[model samples]
Target chain A: MSIKLTILEQMTQVAREQGRTLAPLRDDLALLDSGLDSLGIAVLVARLEDRLGTDPFTNSEDVHFPVTLGDFVKAYENGAP
Target chain B: MALPEALSLRRHVAETQADRFLFDRAARIRIADLVRGTSLDGDPTALHGRSVLIATASQLTSALTLIELDGNARRLTILPPDIDGAHLGALIADAGIDAVVTDGETPHGLHDIPLHVACMPKVVPIDRGRPEHVRTEWVLLTSGTTGVPKMVVHSLTSLTAAIAPRADSDPLVWGTFYDIRRYGGLQIFLRAMLGGASLVLSSAGEPVAEHLLRLARHGVTHLSGTPSHWRRALMASAIGSISPRYVRLSGEIADQAILDNLRAAFPQAAIGHAYASTEAGVGFAVDDGLAGFPASYLEGGCGATEIKIVEGSLRMRSAALAARYAGARGASLRDSDGFVDTGDMVERRGDRYFFVGRKGGIINIGGLKVHPEEIEAVITRHPQVRMCLVRSRSSPVTGALVVADVVLKPTCVREEGRAQVKDEILELCRGALARHKVPASIAFVPELAVAATGKLARLS
Candidate 1:
């Protein structure tokens, strides 16, 4: 699966497991308001780390924490290479 | 009022019922015979008034040596099975050990001790002549959060202050999953010795199933282990083989889930969980089938032990508390008022107080302190979850993030709704815990590693 699809699927799965309904997985949607709290985002990052074999958040010291769905996926894609 | 003469362990053994026995996996020896015989191949008088270290490979041999040397030696330091090898030199120097006792080959790092005595399981019946008047100082090691373990000093009176001799004439067989060298197991050993009860002991490498079968074979009337030890026992198929009349738990926070599960497993047993530590002696035990003790325990006093809470940590003051820390690295064991500060943290809820976790075990998430045990208590409440470990995983976003490793019941593991079970557990955490305390992810594990201390191995 593409990075975007994997992130979106994990986000939905995390949200559903937490008994929360996701509004949408649009690129422009604010990550904070997309029906998941910081805990959900943290879980998503951890799950993504398991699937992709790397954690973009921990790959670099000065890397920014992504703010939206698009930035989250891009962070992984850019850090992948 | 006249002060009674202090009694040593050998004298206590001489006075107890003659039929009591202490059994390990391989051999069973009558308690009375232990005092009549000696495991030391060397002259017993050579060890008198010398600081001796009992560093044996077998718990049974250690027990035999302790029985022989308690009053004879000037100082006897118990060396636990799980002590790290690197700390031995410091320990020997710290305790001022002059003589060494061993079962087989001398334990590594103790070659330089002045006197080396070889001990074997087989007892030799020799007249170990006259008793001495010196009150022996007993030294026990406590595992600190970092560095070498501190040597906690105690006398026979302090160690056995909480143990009350049983009045019943029936043969009460006691068994425990803890090594007798540690404080918890030592208490059980002392109780069995002084109360005229037979004890079934645990070895270093014995499997849980085999231990349960042995306990069953001996017909263990009273059994004790940590909550972690009991959880592992409950998972074993041989759990139904033993029917202990009394069950006790200590050495860790006994949560409601474990207490309730033990009650279901042994409905006939009077289940209780006690609070004790290497430094504080034994504080109290709650036998009303509850997780924590009543809030009244913190009032004026409970029995002979006075309980007080200073800054959310439990502090106990009693004759049972250790006298002081030994060695040059030793510090004052008690506070200004002679209270031993047990590092366990408890929170008051209504008329009772519950242990949250160790004060040193808190995980920092986004600068907020979270106790992993609080989350574990919530996760293990689910019927499908057998046991769980809540730990902190380093996170880039927040300094650290919480995660859980869960072991499901045998039946539930083969069930179809694994994802659904995970969902329910996460939902349970979401409802009961704060956002930060909720585990960011959960992983299903077949089993969790228990430490040599009979507690969960929470390795960072």
Candidate 2:
């Protein structure tokens, strides 16, 4: 239960902070490799920099970046500064 | 030798090779015992030859070699740029020769080059040389266009010698047939020519729709491209177009969807793409994907070969190696066992190898090896930048300078307080990165300048 909530908490906080109260879980937690267009990715990158306190990345044509909130957090921990 | 030495005329090397040997696909025109006194056609009296610049795909090394051995001509073959739309003038001026043998003209943006006064290009020939003897050596130019391009020369003997043994793979192999001008295109050309398969030439400057039109018209059994190329081609097919007998991806990785797409497109045409280099010589192992993407490999003893990763760079022994960089100091590139270091970085995965970025792609910022993609990723994170490019430029104190060319987000209006976005971006990188990894300079352009096909141009 604790692990599952820890995983769910980031999305919960992002939704509350952005005032996007009822947005679907799948939309908020999309992966980097999947097919998000340019504008959608820009929003995700901005939110990541704000939440993670790490500098956001330049845009890429290659990967979509990670989608799941847990996956994004993990990538945040491991990614270069 | 009865051959017309190059100091005479400037044209196809075939014209100069009077008595030595003749190699067109499988049509052998060797100088027989009684034919030693003859000269090849175009035996010009003014052997103070016109200059010729050759530009065929890398796999045409066999034809190139046949030219080198038979015709005593001084031909200048220009190198292809890594990201496309690069200049051939510096290369032209460096060599001081005439006439060029290049892939068709479109990829080169040939007319933009006004300085190229002596430029003459020969398209990749669609004919075949005889089975026993090899004919041309297609020289390959590396991606870096800043200095004289790294020349990977291959010869006719080395190119054609591997034909018979590998020919059995036939219509079953995944990548043996593609456009002869593409890096992998030339490989397929050589494979098909050596194996006795018919060559189907593609129409120049055609879109995916046009490509499928040609494919249907020519009854094309096989198709090949980079990952991006494969994706676009496959997407185009969804609208009901390109259906080849075979499908393969080279020049880049084939991920999960790419593999699935190939299997779906040419269920009967063997599906595969080989990871090869001009230095490594084609013919490597086929990988089964574990991650979202599959890796590549070259089998043990595929040819007279050996592989090494010295200081994290890939090197190989290709019997079909070309001799020297045309105008550089005349030094040979043979190793102790005659294997050349390919300069590609690789990681071992069981018995296979995966491709990484180039060694030169590593930007050394304050004694750090920072991949440009890493920095570019951060810049892209700013919801305001649309596209980004990272490259090393001139630096006085630090050996090389890092510069970023960026296209801002569509909503970010260019006028009235837009300049603050640059500072915000610099501040963002300053917070997340070390001092050096931050770009020394940044250029905010309207749009990123890329080729017609979507490859990023690193060098101007």
Candidate 3:
């Protein structure tokens, strides 16, 4: 599966577990504002790190918290082995 | 009555039992040698009444120089060697530091003051200037839960009031996971010195297994670490071979499972966990093979310290409280009765009170509150689980939901066994925790990252 698809799937799974239904995933959607709060972002980051085998947020010296879905996917893509 | 000078204790130890102080990796350093090597005997007038910052990278050198400076009447502030240049500048400005004594390169923007490294042995005779002792202050930085590290002011008297003098013959080889700059680590460092016991310093940047091996080689009988540190050390194969006489846990809540595991591992060791903070100083230690102190300790049973529960949180009053928070404009740390709110939530479990979690970290889950530590304790009880972290996950329906990240034991890494272990962990949580407390999701990680202070990095 594509990394972006896997990210969306994990987000959906986390949203469903939290008993909230998320809208269809889009690249420009603001993660912090898109129904998921800081905690949700944290869970999503952890899930992505597990599936993708790398955590971009921790790898960089100057970590930029991903504001949108595209930036979040880019972090994983940039850090991919 | 005026308190005894901080250096006087060291002098007495050096005079009587010079051969028994610290056991570094390469050699056993005596108190007499430490005093002679670091003492400012050449120009006492230069450092008199000056505020000094001790920021050495080596724990042994830091401890030695801290004692030397404090003994010489130089006001002292301890900064971790790895403190960022900006943070160091801020701390120096906040504390109004005059001079810094360090082995590391002086940070930029602070090139005005004198930086003294560990000096070679000087043969000048010790001069006893007038018997009057200067009022000295030891400033320590708070762990900075609020992102701004507050400087806590303490006197040598207040810091050492609880430590009882130990006989010279008592055999003690101390080891600690905390850096000497931290309040928890300072307690062990001071305790070892006060007792004239030998201590094995754990060097920073070394592997846990290697440090444990060094301690074992030095015959470390008394050891202390945070629960997370202990869990990691337990995972290390070298830990089983090291026999400690006294095991202590601090820096985080000591759950029952860790305590039980330690007790089972070292049956002869006296297991104790202390609840102490930078502002609160040393509170109390529970030696019983339980998670929390007995309920009776709240009523002045724990020496000079007094404990009370206010608004479901623990508050304490003691002679050992930090004098005041530095640079805090008119901020009061205590109430009229001298009780400082600890900001830690406690739940009464029958006769004992157990720490639920920090008040600030409480997860509000659709009107039900859950503490991540409680969930972590339950999750960590599984034999296959090496370490676990529990945190709140944001939810649209509920304000937050419980989530966990677990690190399994190495033996449980088989693909088929991993699935079964996860199921078993979920089952264990369901049986042990409340419905809302059970984690909604559990992610397995290879290893958990630990902070520089040797604590599990919590999601902030």
Per-candidate RMSD, Å: 2.1, 14.4, 6.8
> How displaced is residue B222 in candidate 1, in Å?
0.9
Query: What is the DockQ of the complex in model 1?
Result: 0.53
What is the Cα-based TM-score of model 2?
Answer: 0.51
Question: How many backbone clashes are present in model 2?
Answer: 64
- What value does the lDDT take at residue B196 in candidate 2? 37
> How many clashes (backbone atoms < 3 Å, residues ≥3 apart in a chain or on different chains) does model 3 have?
0
Against the true structure, candidate 1 reaches a TM-score of: 0.96
lDDT of 3: 0.76
lDDT tens digits, residue span B46-78, model 3: 566778877665777667666565655557888
lDDT of each: 0.87, 0.47, 0.76
**Which structure among the candidates has the greatest TM-score?**
1
Preferred candidate (DockQ higher): 2 or 3? 3
**Candidate 1 per-residue C-alpha lDDT over B1-460 given as tens digits, one digit per residue, 9 for 90 to 100:** 0113366787778876777888899988888776678878978888989999999999998988888888889999999988999999999998999999998888789999999998878778888778565688889998564689999998888888888756677889999999889999999998888777899999878999999999999999999999999999999999999999999999999999999999999999999998899999987878999888888887754678888888899999988899888988898889999999998999998999899988889999878788899999999999988899999998776778899999999988555577888878888988998878888888899999998888899976
TM-score of the first chain of model 3: 0.88
Looking at model 2, give its docking quality level.
Answer: incorrect
On lDDT, the leading prediction is 1
> Each prediction's TM-score against the native?
0.96, 0.51, 0.82
Model 1 bad stretches (over 4 Å): A15-37, B1-5
Off by over 4 Å in 3: A1-81, B1-9, B25-28, B35-45, B114-132, B328-330
Q: lDDT winner between 2 and 3, please give it.
A: 3
